[model samples]
Target: MTSSIPSAVTVPSNNVVPSTSTTTEPSTSAEPVAVAVEDSSNLDNDLLDILGIDPTTDKKYGKDLHKDLSVRLQHWTTVGLDKDLKKELKDRYLTPGNCKLIDPPILNAEMKAAISDINVKRDKAIEAKQKVLTSAIVCLGEAITLLLPSKDKDTNLIKLLMDAIRIICECQHSD
Candidate 1:
């Protein structure tokens, strides 16, 4: 006589059963069977999902990802981020001592100050370059005017123009 056994054991949806089991019959032992546990690393998984980054293909963890995450943390409401998620982002992800993407890890108030400082410096640099270029163009225009065979071409002015042209040529070479 054959004792009939169920081919597949019906466990709860939360529980996982391994597919490599060779036994057709259920165990009669009093001890509990080992089951696969769900991955409880929700924070990492949530970050990956939100960033739309595939861990398998993308090995890069650079400033872009850090900046994106930082922006998300700051502007949580823009993405309709849940309160619990916001809490997790602030508490777990936005720590200064955490990921050092930017030197000293600019975040929150520091990030704001750093950005302002950068903008100010960038603007100043652009203004200074513009001034130099304007000066150079003006000098070139004056040199061209001196070259035009005009009646009032002073020897001193012609010498100055030659010097200006030499300086401009040097600047171009340096650049």
Candidate 2:
């Protein structure tokens, strides 16, 4: 008696690959045990199935599907999840007579005001630094202009001034 194992396993239309193996048991009869392959060779189809996305007619299929899924997930998290949580909270904790919604507008406005103040301070600091840089540049330019025309000007002094200006300019004004 000879037994042959299939070289190429053909996956059916349903994307299930079944492999049968004979196992010897304590009882005289041998039984063929069937094992199923969950995923097929077609990786793209498998991935699409895993993501719960259907193939669309759109040219940008991957991008559109990704965007659609993102929107769906976002909506579920923000609205559906929040609604479920609120319902659970109401069911578990608060009664109808004692229930009062927290005023979020007051907290939101305070946060906005604080952020605006910080932004204003940041803008002011930037403007001050810019003014200082402008003043330094003007002073350097005036010193260079004056020294170039003077007959008694020291070369070493001019070189030192240039080096100072270069150092200052190299240190950028931004944070």
Candidate 3:
């Protein structure tokens, strides 16, 4: 009788690849396992630094910065020179009543007074600038009106043209 058995094939040791599978079992060793934990404090600091924010500063400093930025953005938006640009600025900088910093220092009386004085000056300057701009616009409109056709011949057309110009001037000043 002849017995049949398959011979085992052995790969060369250097050519053999380790199995990719893994098995999990309760650890038998008495030693404690070392766990890797992320330091959240460092992460917070990193985020603050990335955003150009200094959380350790006094509250007053942040408030002052916010106030100044608000004024500048408000002026730019009010000028209405570029609608898209103003919209972008408003979205980025004008979060109403939400400009608090992490830990801002309290402002001293002297500092508060200085800021108040500066704001007063800024308001006056803005008013003067607006007056000048309005004067220029009116002067230009008057010059253009002088060049238009006489109202006696083209009364209806002249009225329409004048109305359109007035609307434009009103729109510009209202902004």
Relative to the true structure, how large is the alpha-carbon lDDT of every model? 0.50, 0.51, 0.47
**What's the lDDT for candidate 3?**
0.47
Residue-level lDDT of model 3, residues 1-175, one tens digit each, is 1112232233333332332224233333443322233344657766867867556664563234477888887876677447575345434432223322211234466765778777756656654444434443444455455657555566565565567557645644553
Tens-place lDDT per residue, model 1, 1-175, is: 1112343344433333453246655555443344334343655767767878556776756455477778876675466657675345344423123312212211356545667777756656654443443445454654666566877768786776767756755553443
List the candidate 1 regions with Cα displacement exceeding 4 Å.
Answer: 1-131, 143-147
Candidate 2, position 58, lDDT: 39
- Show model 3 residue runs off by greater than 4 Å: 1-115, 148-175
Of candidate 1, the 10-residue stretch with the lowest lDDT total is 97-106
| Per-residue lDDT over 115-158 for candidate 2, one digit per residue giving the tens place of the 0 to 100 score | 77777666567654444444455456557768998999899989
Candidate 2 lDDT score at position 46: 64
Q: What is the Cα-based TM-score of model 3? A: 0.23
